[model samples]
Target: MLIMGEVHTGLLRNLGELSETECREVLRLTSGEEPRTWQRPLLYAISPDVLTGVDCRLPSSSGARIRGTGTVSHRATIVGGRVLQGSSYTTLLRSDSDQRLPWSHYLAAPGVVEVYGRPRWQDMADGFVTPEPPMDVLNVGAISGRLMGAVQDSARLDRKTPFKTTRTRLRWLFERDDARGDGRPAMRLTLGRDTMRTLRFTGEPTTDVVAFCEDLALHDWLLTTLQTLIQRALIGTAAPAQIAARLSPAIDHLLHLWMPGARVEEPFLPFWEELERHPGFTRQWTSSVARIRDQITVNTLSLLSVTESRREADGDPSPRRGVPQDRTQSHSHPVRRRIFFRADQRSRRRS
Candidate 1:
């Protein structure tokens, strides 16, 4: 049977944001500090049976992935009136199922680490969202293995068969090294950067990164909208209450392009409901927004080439969608309750 549970920390998510070398460093440190029973250098022993390691390739957008196989250890702590909890998943495999069973365990207590240089916690939020298993990681491995398969099977996507499976393990140790004096935990679980070797992609330039970013423009626009709303709220010029009120309808209309479920009939249910329901929104929001910005910079440098290519293909020159309406155009806004209240006034519209 498959077992899974939610943890509040975002360590894994933040780790995903790091580069491939950084990820390997995490694996190295984790493995070196706590060697697994398994012989592989990539695997770390969280406990006698639990192991943790990197399970996927670095997304062209960001890098953060942690895969564990074995029994997990989990723990909780109370600090400054707030609860800080961290868990180590023991990824274990069974003969009956291909899925790895996550042991819902926690460290006995929280650990502590010194904050080095300027600290950024943006990616940490993705961690709290709690991912829906490591499907992307598994996909990356499968995609690679399929192309390099010794015996290709047309019906099988996971090229690594049961008999040819490359078993990798990973583990983490969250130990309380100090119990007194400093308010921080003696051993806190946070990402530590270390040196690692880079693994090259299988093919060179099969697809240009610029085109990929263009495809994700809609998703980027949503993040930009939310970020603007957040900035306004932070400045106190925009009411948090009002901004929250408009969040759902805004998210719905924004996400409708990529996700049909985002187009809900109801706009005002609790303001935070959309954010709460679609936790992945935040993850994609951060990564996609950064990716679009990066690609725009790259495209700008290669603008001449992109322009010439576009000219050759005769691509649409229309503005790439997503621009906020003026206050004068409030009548066209979806969150305007008066329009919804008046069916006759509603404009026939398509996002």
Candidate 2:
């Protein structure tokens, strides 16, 4: 759908915030909806902002005549006093513009998707170039002379907060004459005494906590790497083989460490041997996938071919059953059979 709107030409060149009334007009035209006082404009275009093409699809090879085959132009006009008083215009470009344009996609956020308004590689590159002058540069000689002063004020205010107050109390405890190493309390819950012998060796509480955190990070890394290797075996063989070949030795080292041990409950002896020995694993896995796919395609073709032949031979007007359909029924029935067979095997294992 295309939306068109006409605005006054006078306020085209001004740059600044627009008035509530002006915003309403733009919203009404583009979104085909009413604008509220609190609502912000999703797409803004003032009169002076010259829109070269309103079409969505235009061929570059078409040269000068290509004129926005699927482009829409929204020109922002800046006028006197920068009040942004001028009216705006909108053009609905053709849908084919999406096809002719080269577009790039990226994850803007978890669910929300943002598409670059332009569809050119150069535009994508140029999009990253910053145009605004730095705030410090704009302020000139009055640069952050009061930065330390503001920081001092913040520090004074923060010192009174309960969290900061706890640190202050802890600091006072450190200065006590009666303070002994064995009397120190736990940093976390107060339920248990965490006294340790004061040693001459240099040891800080912060350093101990940081070391503990680093060990935890290493454990997570090991788990993630192991899972990646396992999943890789199911995906592409060559990539997984290359990764496993490089990482298996390091994984072995981690498993040896008590602090960062492998999470696998069972020994994983067979799984490890399979990965370690199978250079042909990738070739075998890929070949299996190809064979399965080919069998499916060939079976489908043969079933259709057989069904047609049967219909011709019998001269039956009703639809003939294909071999593929029969095979599908046979496959579905095996699921129940397999489940019962596996349960029976488990019963034997228990016995």
Q: Output the number of the TM-score-best candidate.
A: 1
lDDT tens digits, residue span 48-167, model 2:
222222222222221212223322222222111111222122222223333334322111111111222343322221221212223321110111112112222322122221111000
Candidate 2: 10-residue stretch with minimal lDDT: 165-174
Stretches of candidate 2 exceeding 4 Å from the true structure: 1-206, 235-247, 250-253, 258-351
Please list the C-alpha lDDT of all candidates, in the order they appear: 0.26, 0.27
Score residue 214 of candidate 2 by CA lDDT. Answer: 22
Candidate number with greatest lDDT: 2
